[model samples]
Target: MKLLIQNLREYLRADFHPRLYLATAAWLGLLITLNYTFDLEDVYIDSLRGSWKRPVLYILLYTTVYYVAMGLWTYYHHRPDLWRNRRFWLHTGVGWVAYGFYAGFYGYNRWSEQLLDGQIYLFAYYCLSNLHSLVTLVLPLYLYYRFFDNGAEHFYGLKPKRDGLTVYALLLLIMVPLIAFASFQPHFLDFYPTYKDTTANEFLGVPEWVTALVYELCYGWDFVPTELLFRGFMVIGLSRITAVDKNQSGVILPMVVAYASIHFGKPLGETLSSVLGGYLLGVLALSTQSIWGGLLIHLSIAWLMDGAAFVQQWAQQPAGLTP
Candidate 1:
């Protein structure tokens, strides 16, 4: 514990920029306030999926504004060289394109037909459909990394350290109750577990429990791509292009804000909380140089919360009944 504290102190001393930190806080606070005031999440989701035209326009405008701001940020740090750097442009292109493809996958799934019939087939389809992060995000980012850095091991926080794992595991243990406590809230139950259809009796003659187990595993696996993209690619990969000093946390700000923005579709409290959580995880990934810890905490919290919800629902059922 002392070592963990000491490491965190060192991280703070090296990576925490007071002004940038304040800027991130203020920016996220304002965005959250406006989000609740205007209910912009609904608008944002509608704009993204309902129509092809709105989605395209939103992507174009959002990406343009994002890159322009990023260019200005790079300039502010006196790293104008990044603007002309082929590697940086390539990274930027791949990142946005991957995100677009991921979104497209979800949108397609939403609009597509239920052609597959059996419960097992449908369940598998649902799980495999989440591969947008793997297929589009991780793969392309890795290829890009290999192309540029000659297959560096630490490209996206893949190389884990013993001390880092210990610290993050302890941190994950500490978050157990926080997740449980959050599960009691009505709002939390509504969104958590993210898997709604647990009432299926069987799939391919397999029992419902077996199918549920498979579903939960896949559900947990879904977060792998999330960790890869936000913590691994965004924090680790993009940090090279944006940070003036690779040792500092300046590059983490953009990723943090963007991460928070993605949570806009969630409940207000969770959305607001994601800003701090996202930033901390990003910093942890940066400090430890591994997403394994982030993945552990993320997957644990997610699965536990889902379990809590399932238990609560079960308890509410009649004595002889089953979900």
Candidate 2:
């Protein structure tokens, strides 16, 4: 127990930067204000159905608000050196452009499915469809890092490191039962198994399990872009441009705010919890310089929550019957 506590302490060091906090607060405040002012969260969710206007407004609002907040934070903190860093502005520009591609691709794919047509195989279509995020968010940064930057591995947080693997493992162990406990809530079950369509089953003329296999794989891969964008690019890549020391990364909380904002369309509880979860994951990525652990933890929670929801749905069925 003593050794275990030591290991946890070693990995879980507190990183509190005043400017980062202020910037995060401003970012969150802007999101909350917009959400309350116009019910933007619901509007944004509605946009996924067919309205391009709301999403475009959201992307514009988000980028403008966040960059303004960051600029003010840098000025107030008197970090003219950071402000003058051409790499800083360059990287920030790349990140926002990447975000535009992310939001655009997500909105496009979510609202329109024409690009996903013409696949002869069901699983192939599923796999290709999953590449939507990879193509938009991950590929642009990846290509830049690989070709322009001359390396895509470490900058993208793909380098292998075991620094905090134990802490992450322990956290995952504790999280599993807590996630199961949450799964028992009616609201939780209603929101999960997020792969609701199941149209693939009928389209492929295959059993539900077969379709599930494809859906889960695609769903799991969805996080790759997520991690790459937030943890890899925003946190790690931005650190190179903004870090003042080994321990302090100015970009962490800003990334957290943006990461949490992306969850605005989710359930309120999950969306709020994302702030904390995103922060912790961002810290881990910075400390260990790898996102694979976070990837594992995210997939574990997502798949487990999905499994729990499935189990609850099964149990709710009438006396030993299959749906």
Highest-lDDT candidate: 2
Worst 10 residues of 2 by lDDT: 111-120
TM-scores, in order shown? 0.82, 0.82
Q: What's the count of clashing pairs in each model shown? A: 0, 0
In model 2, state the lDDT of residue 75.
65
> Candidate 2 clashing pairs?
none
For candidate 2, lDDT tens digit of each residue in 288-314? 778888888888888998898888888
* Error of model 2, residue 265, in angstroms: 0.5
After the best TM-score superposition of candidate 2, give how far the Cα of residue 258 lies from its true spot, in angstroms.
Answer: 0.6
> Could you tell me the lDDT of residue 28 within candidate 2?
82
- For model 2, the stretches where C-alpha displacement exceeds 4 angstroms are 1-23, 26-30, 33-38, 44-55, 72-76, 106-129, 150-155
lDDT of each structure?
0.66, 0.69
Which pairs in model 1 have colliding backbones?
none
